[model samples]
Target: MTLLSLSGVSFAYAAGKTVLHGIDLAVRDGGNLGIVGESGSGKTTLLKLLLGLERASAGTVSFRGAPLDARDRGFMLGFRRSVQAVFQDPYSSLDPRQRVSDIVAEPLRSLKIGTDIAEAVAQALRDVDLPPDAAGRYPHEFSGGQRQRIAIARAIVARPALIVADEVVSALDLTTRTRIIDLMRALSTRTTFVVVSHDIALVALLCERLVVLEKGRIVEEGATREILARPSHPYTQRLLASTPRMPARG
Candidate 1:
């Protein structure tokens, strides 16, 4: 079943400069997809369109066969409730003033989800491998990896069907990156993931399929393993050649 789809979608800024052009993509329910491209490749713009932060200039963006119309409050609310996001820069994404429990419970509270907010927060923390006591602390108290875990905890606390992750591990060091990737991998078994990253190696570990974008267009797309092994596009081949291989796990 298709959870989200973009058909001939296009976007342009007020200056009339196009950022994305006639893009077509679909993400199935429980699918794991990666969008990869260098800077100025419309990767982030595509995400913005998916999130409804920006409207498509032409064509359609749909969720579960219905058009994404922000004016329709019911549809907008349902879409927001079903989809969650995790971004890069754990330090900045979280509020230093808010306790971890409150941070994780924000969505539940704002969305008026469960009646037992405390239980939801605790379970979320546990799911991310953090101790129960850790919820009382502020974001500054945790290390970078731990903070990202908290972010992940908050994202999944609502049991969202889809999670959009944008450069989620780019700020961390090698060891921390690996641990976070492993956490996401474990979560992907139950959640659909749309990962956007310039790090091909990291995306390869988390996604089964990939969409390679260039200058506002999809240049290549296929199974992750196939593209990695036999890239047909020059741009994709360049990406593969430039990405440093991750060291083998012991």
Candidate 2:
């Protein structure tokens, strides 16, 4: 079953520059997919299109076979509640003025879910393995890793069915990155994820399927093992070659 799909989607900037051209992609329900390419490969633009943050220049974006449109108000609201996102910069994505609890509760409050905001906030913090007392602190009070964890907590508190993690771990340290990746995998039991990144090796480690984009189009896609072991496209090979190998451990 396809949970989210982009069929013949295309998008262009106001300057008349095309970013994505005739792209087609589908993510199976509960599957983890990684979209990888160099900068300016239209990966982020594709994410925006998926989120409906930007409209498609052509073609259609459907969620569970239903087209996302204003007429589908109830469906759009449900979809928004079901599909969440965690962006690249945790520090910037969070509001500096808001306390951790408030930040996590914003969605619940906005959506008028009628749940106890305090309890929902507490549960979200606990799910992310954050200390209960941690909720009282502001975003400035936490380290980079902790901040990213807070971001993750906020994304999951809504109990979203699908998550678009756009380079969520790109700026973290190796240890922190590994922990977040593991957290993401654990979270996948409840939600599907679309992880977009430039690091082929990291994507290989975290995702089951890989889609390699080049100049706004998909050049290669396959099982992670197949693409990593035997890349067919020159662009895919270049990305593989450019990826640094991890040091061997004794």
Give the whole-model CA lDDT for all candidates, comma-separated: 0.91, 0.87
Q: Write the per-residue lDDT of candidate 1 for residues 1-250, one digit (tens) a residue.
A: 9988999999999999999989999998876999999999999999999888989999999999999999998888889888899999999999999999999999998877866889988988988899999989999999999999999999999988899999999999999998999999899889999999998888889888899999999999988888888889999999989998643221
Worst 10 residues of 1 by lDDT: 241-250
lDDT of 1: 0.91
TM-scores of the models, in the given order? 0.97, 0.95
C-alpha RMSD between model 2 and the true structure:
2.5
Which parts of model 1 are misplaced by more than 4 Å? 246-250
Best by lDDT: 1
How much does each candidate deviate from the true structure in C-alpha RMSD? 1.8, 2.5
- Residue-by-residue lDDT tens digits, candidate 2, 87-162: 9998899999988999999878776677878988899899888999988999999988889989989888888888
